[model samples]
Target chain A: MIVAEQKPFAEIAGFVADCNKILVAGCLGCVAVCLAGGEKETEILAAALRMHRRLQGKPLETVTYTATRQCDPEYVDAMADLVKDVDAVVSLACGVGVQYIAERYPDKWVVPALNTRFAGGSVAQGVWEERCGLCGECILHKTGGICPIIRCSKSLLNGPCGGSQYGKCEISKDVPCAWQLIYDRMKALGRLEWLLEYQPPKDWSKSRDGGPRKAVREDATI
Target chain B: MNLTTESRLEKLLKRGEFVVTAEIGPPQHASAHEIVHHARLLKGYVDATNITDCQTAVVRLSSFAAAVHILREGLEPIMQMTCRDRNRIAMQSDLLGAYSLGIRNLLCLTGDHQSFGNHPTAKNVHDLDSIQLINMVKRMRDDRVFACGEPIKEHEPRFFIGAAANPFADPFEFRVVRLEKKINAGAQFIQTQCIFDLERFSRFMEMVVERGLHERAYILAGLTPIKSIGAARYMQKNVPGMIVPEELVQRLRKAKDDGKNVADEGVDICVEFINKVRKIKGVAGVHIMAIAWEEIVPTIVQKAGLYPRPKAD
Candidate 1:
């Protein structure tokens, strides 16, 4: 999931400071799942902007619409009829969706209303935490399902370093040592021998270290 | 007569009969027709109509506006204000605005978390919890000044502030303590979360009596009729801290099996629940939350034998 948090109200106001006719776009994809850019949230932001603009004696003509998914050309094309009259479009989707809107509507300026954060699930009722780094690698089979790459502060692959104490990380007493959890899980599963095997260093080229990635199949193309 | 806050609460308590109250949900859209309709339905039958502000975190017409509409329709309104959307500054300003509009009764709540509501991206400003909001109202009533040291030259608001409690939400022992804390924070009355299990309510009332808070404030039990078997199941699983007893569910199921009208059976369940609550010694009244079924409130009140009695001093 591409998690994002809505920018502060003041910052949003500043972004649309010049535009009189603004289209506040919302995405019903990953951003909606995280409660960042859903239909309801789009309306609220529009209301707040209207109220703030009224208070400042600078009225604005704001229209809100939520595309099924902002990342796809079909969904972004659906909003073309609504975007004609607007001076600028404020995209409330993730970075990819924002870029897609900008690419599709090259004439109109597109502003991002959310800061895309890492992919994660809600830890508790109202809390969200990062879980994956999207490094384009899967090493869980060797680490007993615990990803030391993301969970460990140093992202150490070998084992627990001298910084680990009493199952806790040296960086913070509250943080559980990721390698310790990995060791305990492997020991329980009789897979402790996997840790002793010398593994090659991760290839960073497949990740963001290289340029933007794309996937295509010649047989599937029309 | 400009009655003091104390005098108003005292007058309600001294009357001693069941004080009926009804809820008014503010509209999400700009239209006030729905709010006015509910207010008109409950005008004379209820003592006060509660205007809920952005209930469950969805944006709605301001409670202050709803209260004004209620007052215009010649009914007292209990403005339900939650500390979810605004900071202390805005809350204080809105309170003064509500007072200026002649709204006297206030129900303070630490609103439902924004995650549960439709607007997930909306930032929640829990500047002050419910207890602190109650205290702020009390301060404004007494000193006629806000936390920011702003003086009110206008007539001071004599607000009969109320709070909410969920006896079924917490352990039995903690319910009493929570009620006591609310009372200490200057809550003149309390409307509990929906009550399905009367036996538990009786035990809760017993605890209130043990703490000597039964006499200090009016405790209004909340009761909502279960419209269908699906609704009964939904309440048990989804609604936090709500316990719909097996007997009531079984009764509704039986009603369904008999091929009788389900809504009428739901009303019968509500009537029975109200009667059970009335027999409990410490329950001052019952707040019937018939969600979107405002038309049936009068019927429920009439069935519960809670017609507006002559105020006895």
Candidate 2:
């Protein structure tokens, strides 16, 4: 899932300061699950924006709407009516949702209210950790399901680079060394021999390095 | 002395001579004066000097460029390369460039994380790990091909490859195995992290001897002379993969209480470490890393009876 966190209230307030009225948009996708940009958050942001503006000399109005999934065109198009009277649209979804809303409403001023963090899932209550690099290829079968691409600080294919001390990464004690985890997992599974083999340099061209990527489903396309 | 030896360190180690190497941290500012000064100070006392590649991830004069400065001082340089800053393309390009500039030895490392550096928010490019980097360099030399296996139509970079080891790092049982892994990946020599816990380092060397890894590649013990009690305490609390024993710290404190220079005591401790590790089987040499205090290296080398470095033509 695409994780994100809301922008500071003051920053959001400044974005719509000149506008008399604005639309606060939310998504029911990854941001909602992460407790960031959901329906409840949208209302809280809208009320705060109005109060912040009212405290100043000028007053502001807000209309809030939460889409099923803001990345989809159909869900974004549903906000056409709510966006018509507003001067600006404040998207509380990931970057994708802000772009989708902007693409749907060509002339409307759309600004992101949240910063898209990474593609990860909630680890515990109110906590999330990244799990993938989206590197276009997966080698979990060889590494005991541990992904060094995103987990290892150096993204080392052959690692536990002398920096692995006490199962923690050299960067921080809080961050567990990914190669250590892989070593333990492989050792437990009697696959330690697999780690002895060298892994070649990754073909980054398969990743974003090749440019904006696309996955076509020719059979399912309309 | 092997007057015609191109790689003094490699030749000395092969001839079973106890060699010595020192590290020179390039200046953060754009100047080669520090490098040249240290090279001059360490010329006749050490076999070769290692030019660090942004040690601790802080930005500094590049190791390759510093290698050139060291060569100008009539000293051989073991140019260090890290995977943190470059991908294979840039690494190979620098390898060729370093060799073209008369740099002979190469030390490949998976550098310290960027978060520890001055540029904390910088993006890192670990496109290759140390093991793979060693293998790539070996192929580029032995097979006369690039990392992609394409034949090198021109002169190839034939570096005497070296890798780093941390005997004090966790999963202590696996440290020796990883050393063997590095040797299998074509590392001609191994320089370990600084050793303050002699007992633990001795045990790590015992395992290496049992497996006969010492026969495959030369092993060099790393030593660092502590400047003061404060620096010792800082390394104990902050530096990763480092073990600064309390006993050594107390010795420095005792020196301060006796009204003696703490730095002289630091050099004494370093010289003592060299003598102890020298007796251990399979320990080929010592690599002193007297950071910011390269002038003390000559004293330590002389006290340890490793002075009058072998001449190589």
Candidate 3:
């Protein structure tokens, strides 16, 4: 899932300082699951913005709406009536959702209230850790189900690099060395010999190095 | 793998001489004065000098340019190349450029993370790891082909490839295996991380000797003389992949408390490490990384009886 964090209240307030009325939008997808931009979060943001404006010797109006999925055009089109009266739309969704809202109401000002971080799942209750590099190619079978592409600080193929100490990366003690994890996993699985084989240079053309990527599904298009 | 062209350090190591190499950190400014000064200081006392490449990811004069500066002073330079800043294309280009500029020895390394440097927000380009970088250089040199395996047609850069190892780092049992992997990837020599814990380094050498890895490539023990009690404490508590034993710190503290010169004690400790490691079987040479304290390298080399450096044929 794409994890995101809500922007600070002051920054969000500053974005709509020129506007007298605005709509606070939220999403029910990844952002909501990460407890960042759910329906409850949207109402709370809207109320807070209104109160903050009222205390500044000026009054402001705010309407709130939560989309089932802000990335889709249809869910964003549902907010057509709510956006007609507002000066700008403050989207609490990820970057994708902010663009969707902007595209739907091309005339109205649109701004993102959350910063989309990484494609990761919730590791603990409120903490999320990245697990994928989106490299467009997977080598999990060879690495004992550990992903070194995103986990290793150097993203080394035949790691751990000399900087791996005490099972942690040289960057920080908190970050576990990905190669250490791979080594332990491969050892447990009796696949230590697999690690001995040389891993050649990766063809990064399949990754972001190839430019913005897309997925095509002809079967589902119809 | 035996296709070397022009590296004095490589020749000395090949001749089984206990070579002594020291590092020269290029100035953060563009001045070449420090490189020349350090080169002159180390000329007769050491085999060759290593020009660090923006060590710790702090921006500085490039190692290639620094090597050229040192080479001008009649000293051979083991030019260090890190994988943190450049992609495969840029790295290959630099390899060709360095060779064309009369640079020979090349040390491949995975550079320190950018967060440790002044430019913390800079995006790192680890397109190739140190192992991959070594292999790429080998292909270009031994195979007479570029990293893409296309013909170089003429003048393929033949570098005396080197790589770094950290025996003190964890998954400690696997450090030796990693060294072997580096050797397999065509690293002609291995310069390990700084050693403060001689016991652990000795054990690491035992494993290297048992695997007979020492026979395949030259292994240089890395040494850094502690400058002061503060430096000792910093390396013990802060430096990554470093193991500074408590006894060494206590010795420095004892020296300071007794109103003795801490710097001299640091040099003594470094010379002691050099003497001990030289006695261990399969130890090829020593690479001293006295970062900002390049002056003490001459003293350490002299005190360790490694002076009057061998003239490589």
The number of the candidate with the highest TM-score is 3
Best by DockQ: 3
Global Cα RMSD, each model: 18.9, 1.9, 1.5
- Candidate 1 chain B minimal-lDDT segment of 10 residues: B1-10
lDDT of 2 by residue, B146-208 (tens): 988899987888888999999999768778877888899999999999999999999999999
Error of 2 at B43 (Å): 0.6
Prediction 3 global C-alpha lDDT:
0.91
- Ranked candidates (DockQ, high to low): 3, 2, 1
- TM-score, each model? 0.59, 0.97, 0.97
Candidate 3 docking class: medium
Residue-wise lDDT of candidate 2 within A152-216, one digit each (tens)? Answer: 98888876888788899999999998988998999999988888787888888888888989999
What lDDT does candidate 1 reach at residue B109?
A: 83
Task: Tell me the lDDT of model 3 at B107.
Answer: 95
Question: Residue B118's C-alpha lDDT in candidate 2?
Answer: 96
Ranking by TM-score: 3, 2, 1
| Superposed model 1: Cα runs more than 4 Å off | A1-222, B1-3, B6-10, B149-154, B309-313
Tens-digit per-residue lDDT, B1-313, candidate 1: 3335633333665567578788878888888898888888886677777788887778889999988998898777888988778767798888878887788889988676565578977766655656667777887888886755587676766688899877775334445665676777778889988889888888888889987998888899898987888898887766655788888888888887999878889999899988888888788888888876888898888887777634424
In the range A1-222, model 3's lDDT, one tens digit per residue, is 999999999999999998999999999999999999999999999999999999996788999999999999999989999999999999999999999998888899999999898888988899999988989889888899999999988789987877778889988899999999999998899888898788899989899999999999999997
